[model samples]
Target: MTKKLTGVFLVLLGLFATGTAAVAAPPPSGSTDPVGNDVSWPQCGKTLPVSPAFAIVGVTGGLANNTNPCLAEQLAWAGKSSTGGTSQPRVAVYVNTANPGHSGSWWPSSNTYANVTVSNPYGTCGSGGGGAGPVDLPCSYIYGYAKAYDDATIRGVTNPGTYFWWLDVETGNSWQAGTQDATALNRATLEGMATYFKGITAGKKGPDGKPAGVGIYSTGSQWGTIAGTVPPGSPLAGLPSWLAGAKTLRGAKSNCSLPGLTSGSSVAVTQYVAAGLDYDYACR
Candidate 1:
């Protein structure tokens, strides 16, 4: 379907987005500390060729840094996406209530021709609500969120082939900082969101009739300290597993300052420098 036609469908179906941070270049490489920083770029996702200790690629996104124009091409080459008619790239936008997107912003997404995942409506489970909802109940508002996504799909998105709708499991708290009382998240809170997310994308159908499991986001530190430690059969177990970390991405030095998060494994897609960055999900 044409882009215009797709937009029309989304409006009729009421499925769309509406609404931001980050790294200091030339400071020093591989320093998570806000004070210390990185000054080099790897043009790769692993780490420096000679010094493998420093990460080569890192993921960053938010209103602050998403606008780096060269990021996409860097990723395409980094992943060697040019092989097999694969110029398209899969992108994940990171957000919270703070940067919820404008009424009609299009995120730079993957090639409509390919089969891949693009999840939006991103952030922490019990967060971004302005503290109106409960702190964190197992399957708290997450079930409702699943129902909403499923419910929208049933009505039919403009181009189901072009886009797949999914919500963020955690906001700023997707990582841990070893400090007390940051971003309002805990095991139960995470569990509640994860359970609901699981129902929507991976397991049995939700009450709203959406499929099971879609996609998820969390930093590498969050993976090891938070999600990794979760017991088996929990909501987070089924996540697509994008372990956000610190490293060079497409020849840029990117960084994120989300609380409770630290670096670890590499992410499937990197979202460094998120201000004004264009991204979208291709519904072929």
Candidate 2:
């Protein structure tokens, strides 16, 4: 095999080995402290050897650049499976409000509003590759609506109010820096998304009989770099947090004790990377 193909094979093999080893024994019992896993297009068509206590399937393939090819199948699996005697499953979407490439880019200010013409100097956005032009809604609204639309249209999620939604933010994706204004814009983008979801699920209640809440899936450092310190009394501060960047189950469990980026919000989940697989520890 070519070097590139060899590298890819090794990575996959490593992931498989790690996933298998990690679940060699059944997870701990209890509905309150459930164990779960999250996946994207990469794991499509493969059945997990061990059934997760819960699952968080991905909707966007990468930074909203495109929809996941296996989104339908993943959603179906989540919907069909029951965890802790609950039918509802968790779902997550990629968020990159300031990436400078692709139609999903949210930088340059013009792309912040719904229904407006924006100039893309970085050769991102649209088929022709960036320039002055009218685009769809802002990145936040577009991402929020795209996620809700995909869940409803493709996954048959008629009432999204029933499931928990997570926004995946990571340093692996693009971000803004060098200026305070850039940070503010990023915060606005995130808040816009939360606002949209809140509006849609206003009167709707989840299977738990509570309005579904939006949560941030990120590490404190990553969040600080992208959006800066979450302002006091900010709406984002009230949303739940899903901590990431742990390397082991022990580390992940420890992360659960860390304070959330939002002042009022607490860490609801902690993610650990094992054998290249993303596993979650839900905080009871």
lDDT tens digits by residue: candidate 2, 1-284: 00011122433443332111223333433224456777665565554425666677666545434445566666666544525432324443333223332344433323333453433222223324455332323443243343434443454344565556677666555544565465665665566556656655666665535346577887788788877877775557778888887777878889989998788888877887555457788775
What value of lDDT does candidate 1 attain over all alpha carbons? 0.28
Error of 1 at 82 (Å): 13
Least well predicted 10-residue stretch by lDDT in candidate 1: 275-284
Reference-based TM-score of each model: 0.33, 0.69
Error of 2 at 234 (Å): 2.7
Predicted candidate 2: what Cα RMSD to the true structure?
Answer: 7.5
Best by lDDT: 2
Provide the lowest-lDDT 10-residue window in model 2: 1-10
Question: What's model 1's TM-score?
Answer: 0.33
Runs in model 1 deviating more than 4 A are: 1-212, 222-228, 250-267, 273-284
Candidate that scores best on TM-score: 2
Error of 1 at 226 (Å): 6.0
